[model samples]
Target: MNGIEAPNRLAELRQAAALTQQEVAERVGVPVSAGQVSRWERGEQAPSLRYRHRLAAVFGVGVADLGIPSAPLPRQRSSAEDWFVSDEQDPRVTKSQDEWRRTRALLNQNRHSLSQVAADLYPEHRLAGTGLIAGGGWIPEQPVDLARIELSEVPDAPEPVLSGGEREAARMLPDQTLTRSYDRYTRAVRDLAPPRLFEDRVSWRLLDVDWSAGAGRMSFGDTTYFNAVDVFEPCAHELAYVALDADGGLAAHPHMRDLPYRKLIGSPFDFARRPVMPAISTLTIRRGAGDDVSFLLHRRDPRAVAAAGGMLQVIPSGIFQPSSLMPAGRAADFDLWRNIQREFSEELLGMPECDGHGRPVDYTSGPFAVLDQARADGRLTVHCLGVALDALTLVGEILTVLVVDAPVFDSLAADFVERNDEGTVVAERFPFTEGGVRGLLDSGSVAPAGAGCLELAWRWRDVLL
Candidate 1:
């Protein structure tokens, strides 16, 4: 095939493989942009010999099958052959890396502002003094029963159907933005590997919540971690990419002009369009006596985690999921306190995460036993504050506070690690006082659910203490 026909054929191969331009760019063994792939596919630009070979490998085809000649074209020659050139040596890769650096900086700078805009857009769900939204009368200070949360098996939950505009945008734009970001993150954090097992792990999707009977009555359906990552996480990044203008001003992307939360408000329980996954965020307070209380905070390492990176969050925050994929494990792990115990183990003690592949956790032994004993002895109190949805990502959070008496906290504190898989503990525990809580809120670095939990815990200190 000629040069023009060869480029056109590349597009057909990519479509046949069911891959996006971004995915193709990522798998091409180089740091290239989706736009570059688009240009190559449209015949607006030609791939160098090195790229052509890499592209052939990515598509699992021979060079001839890709319709590219084995020999380099006369016009493609430079001072050095393409095969000898490293990613760093390629000016295109350098430019793409530079752009990514700028984008990361911009995201870090404007994240708080974007969150505020999200909160404003969903006023009805917005909780005061926090960048969170509580629904179903579940407000901070209200306690929920762990037993009341019900789970329904959804073995064949249908995938959400995108609007025509959304589908077109998904088709044209890069779909692997979050995955690419995650790749960059894992590369930077040597110890952090891609969550290959965790992605396929089963999760509980929030179907409905009712609080009319005092405590929260929640209904959940089976979902998977891959679903949240594939659908909602990318939507969050897409909003950030398109909504933020060159000058850092806010404007909605044409495809996502409608608010996701607005569409679901009328029938929040319906999981046909958006399957919300609620993360459990607990404010762990160490109470010594009358007014001597302190709370732990975590600065999530941006390079290690996918969401809420670089933000101050309540310690021991994690998705509400089972420890094992076994049906028995799923049934037993549905309790809120059990999930919190796992988070405490992973985030605070630096233990290996419960990746849903291991045997069912034995709450009768190890750290779980210690925590369970403390709760039984009345030395630890776990309370569910409320449930809220993040305005930007439409992700849900079950806000909670776990107050440990001095002796129990001291025992656990002795084993607390400086850093865990997710992040490091803020150097010292902040006093659980109005001033301390106010300082964190004003700093604009706290995660929405963390802020909500802190505010609510402080507000109800009289009752909790």
Candidate 2:
């Protein structure tokens, strides 16, 4: 009748006929079992187009009697010009076309449509009431209140479901050199070498990792034996912890504390058995020309020793550091933005490059300064779009949308690329179209975290747009 949640009369008709779902399935010749028919009755899945006619014939009613508009067969015309004439001449066709346009508008306006939201949040999972019927397209009949949507956590009432996609993505990483080559960074990235100098920077404690297989709960330990050839795994349970910096700031050293026995069973490329950690994936979108929005991501150089090399991914994604959880000083404020900006500079701005000698240079202050300038000029705005908790990982994303004048965008683009080239970052761009976003999603070069961030940005385009 409206969205996917609107009740269909199929169940009522079946009961009236004293027919079982199996009988209906047999009469309709649909390959699915009786349970699927029950799903349609429960408003879980809409019947596909191929089965609609069968249902109508079995129920001895028109398709419209099943709560869907009946589309007339196309008119057979003598000439192509006659087709246009026929369309203009037919009131039913014209009315149907108008109704379609109005319905499409309503669908777009209803940002909280249950089926659409389900598609966005759980692309990996298939719900009962949503599928593509030929004439009906994909029907999702549920209506939801946008205000009641959960942000930080999954719902306890309906329960969060895990699909196979998460495990698939994690397990399907391509085989490559897994170890980080620290020696290779001695020249260019000498300054950025992770300083495990202070006692607080490294977590010596072993963390127990255990939780419901599908829920966001996960376990992490320190990265004691992280090697260049080893891949990161998100196992069901593993010992891991956050890496910190000297001043009690977040260092984000991509190492996890894993026991030898746990490490033996996990392949770096497989994520099925890896531990999940508290982390953030940031999308700093910038408003571009009218009706267009832009965001930047960078590709890591293949030669770089960083975990994600030769990939176009979220340039600034990292786990929550110790400083965020426990500030060393009273004056230090707990803020995620501080870490996000730090990562942005470390990856995109390329501040960690070395001087003529192999000694480290100071590029630490650059990201902060740029952000401050952007804010002062009214070019920055930040939003927490909410948490995306999938089987592989649980992360809170901070969407920072920036609106810059043309002159500033050009200047920033040039500087961002030039600076990051010396470090791990190889290329950068602001993708602004659906095709471009899809390319990133399909790219094997995008980091998993970057891929997840890109997906969240695209699926939540309604909020950003």
* TM agreement with the true structure for every prediction: 0.70, 0.39
lDDT of 2 by residue, 1-465 (tens): 356554678888888767799977666542556876887677656664435544654564555678743442343322322322222223443333233222222222221221223233234442221210011111112211112222232112221122212432223222112231112211111111111111113211112221222222122333211211122222211111122222323234232232332234333212233322334556556676785567766655422222333445555654434332232420131244555655666555555522112332222355576675765676654444333322222222222233345455565556664435412443445566788877755544454445555654566566555
Clashing pairs in 1: none
Worst 10 residues of 2 by lDDT: 131-140
Q: Find the 10 residues in a row with the least total lDDT in model 1.
A: 188-197
List, residue by residue over 1-465, the lDDT tens digit for candidate 1: 464445447888999877799977766634567887887786656666456655754664544567644443345433323444532224443334334333433454466666777677657767775767666465633565454454455556665553213432242122122233323221311111221122456788876666656555666776766565555543444456656876567765333245442343333324566667789999999989777899999998654465676798998898988999887888889878899999999888888887899888888888999998888888988887777877666678888889899999998889899988777898688998889989988888998889888888878887677
